[model samples]
Target: MELRNRSAFHEYFFETTYVAGIVLVGTEVKSLRAGKVSFNDAYCQFHKGELYVKNLHISDYAFGTTQRHEPTQERKLLLKKKELRKLEAKIKEKGYTIVPLKIFFNDRNLAKIEIGLGKGKKLYDKRETIKKRDVERDLKRYVK
Candidate 1:
């Protein structure tokens, strides 16, 4: 499957899990199917025991008028209660965050979002990651 924008892996280290079932407006779903969505700067937050995604941009459907949904409004994420509890606990103890990794359609034609449990990386850690990536790239070129 093709991936859209990926957050800087150097900036956030993730432990990921797959989650299913998110409610979206008709326009949003249509925009997504047309590949007019952006995950950049999007993040997940827990509110009143439910998870919500904020700052995700789903562009307006061309056929839609002013009634079209806002591009960056908060969207609810569907997850089990037990899983929510587990995520809450881990976030509290480990200072981790939830982020949307990817959005895709499953075989059933349902929209699914892949979320990740992650920790923010420090400045030095980011530099280290960049250095490692450069080295890997160099190695690949040399091998070729």
Candidate 2:
């Protein structure tokens, strides 16, 4: 199953995207398969030369035992060293953020996340996007 953050497009303009592996406990993985995950407040942060994701909530498994993982924990993200360095440099600038766009299990059954380098949209930018979308919708409807 794939979980997507639809609001990402409305909230920010994505510059580049990369897929990264997420470190999850057994319970977390099980929960993800059941579609018990939320990206409402999750964001990627660079910490001590490594990248970590915070506020990514993976609900506890229904059949979890006493070792259930916390719902909201800082999960480490695995990315290549060169990519990490590149992201680090870009993020150090103002207004750029690393945001999770989606989460899905790859072919090998491992959880992977799609992250984007984004800059938040201003009020006018958001309004412009809305207007553009409205025009596109009208055009599509007329074509049909």
Candidate 3:
């Protein structure tokens, strides 16, 4: 199952994106496969030179045993050292932050997440985005 954080697109202008593997527990994997995840207020952070995603809610598996995983715990992300350094450097700059864009399973059945380096949008920018979307929808409907 592929899940996207649509609100992230509305709030930030993404400059670059990276697909990284996630560190998940047993129940977490099952929950993800079952599409029981939420990206509310989820974002990425750097800790001790490693990348980790915080506030990502992967719900508990319905049939899981008593040893359930925490839904909003911080989870590590796997990426190359070079890429991590690049993201870290960019994050050090003003107005640059890391946001979780989407999550999907690769062909190998491994869970992966797309993270983006983005800058927050201003009020007018957000309005323009909404206006553009409305225009596109109207145009598509007219053509159909």
Candidate 3 Cα errors over 4 Å, as ranges: none
| Candidate achieving the largest TM-score | 3
lDDT (10s digit) by residue, model 2, range 1-144: 899988889999999999999888768988888889888878999889999999888888989888799999999999999999999999999999999999999889889999999999999999999999999999999999
Model 1 lDDT per residue over 31-138, tens place? 888889887888888899889999989999999866689899989999888898998888787668888887888888888888888889999988898899999999
Candidate 3, residues 56-141, lDDT tens digits: the string is: 99998989998799999999999999999999999999999999999999999999999999999999999999999999999999
* Backbone clashes in model 2: 0
Report every candidate's CA lDDT: 0.83, 0.93, 0.96
Q: Give the C-alpha miss distance for residue 140 in model 2, angstroms.
A: 1.8
Q: Candidate 2, residue 114: CA error in Å?
A: 0.4
Q: Model 1 TM-score?
A: 0.89
**Alpha-carbon error at 32 in model 1, in Å?**
0.6
Clash counts for all predictions:
0, 0, 0
